[model samples]
Target: MYKFASTASIAAPSAQLTLSGSGVFIFQIGSALGTSLNSQIVLVNGALPQCVFWLIGSSAVLGSGCKFQGILMASASIGFMDGASLVGAAYAQNAAVTLINSVITVPPACNL
Candidate 1:
């Protein structure tokens, strides 16, 4: 389990991130220069006011019961679990998006 603030950027080798309280979290899942290829995961338990995921050369998998208020950019894929809520958008280039019983308020507008 890891704790992060909304203003901070997260870059880790681990695949899973767990949020336990009410706040925002910004995650830099992959390399910004497109130099790495790795998969990332996020688990939110409470009011996640804002959450941003930036994937330059990787993918992101979101857990259930999360309230997001930012964007998700993935070079590979962006997957949402059951009961997950996204108030923003998800951009998946060169891949697809998988939503299983999830709610996305604003659909992604890809530059494809």
Candidate 2:
């Protein structure tokens, strides 16, 4: 649904997808390999937790001090760098989940 080559930091607004914190954002790389996210803030504006980043046959990475919202699903692996935090959930289907000083919080149960 969303595609991105690389990004630094994201703090913008979207009219289609509405995130919870401020605005909605979707950053995705191609179907090649996984991508390493070196961002500080990754906020997806929504009322409930949604699958924000879904990688099939690839891996996902969150850099240090990164703050993210929404669910991240991958088929390979998911890595959280130092101090990276997630306000949603993460699933590395066929691989592993590595966290180094990173925190992953399960959001409130959606009632909808």
Considering every candidate listed, which one attains the maximal TM-score?
2
Angstrom error at residue 81, model 2: 0.5
User: Which pairs clash inside model 2?
Assistant: 4-28, 18-45, 19-44, 19-45, 19-46, 20-45, 20-46
Q: What's the CA error at residue 82 for candidate 2, in Å?
A: 0.6
Model 2, 1-112: lDDT tens digits are 5675543224332112244543333556543222234443333444445545444346777666666666676667888877878888888888898999888888765444
87, model 2: CA deviation in Å? 0.5
C-alpha RMSD by candidate, in order: 9.6, 6.0
lDDT (tens digit, per residue) of candidate 1 on 1-112: 1222222232342233345555544555443211111223344565342344343455666555444445777777777766656667878897888888878776443232
User: What are the clashing pairs of model 1?
Assistant: none
Candidate models: Cα lDDT each: 0.52, 0.58
Report the alpha-carbon TM-score of model 2 versus the true structure: 0.61
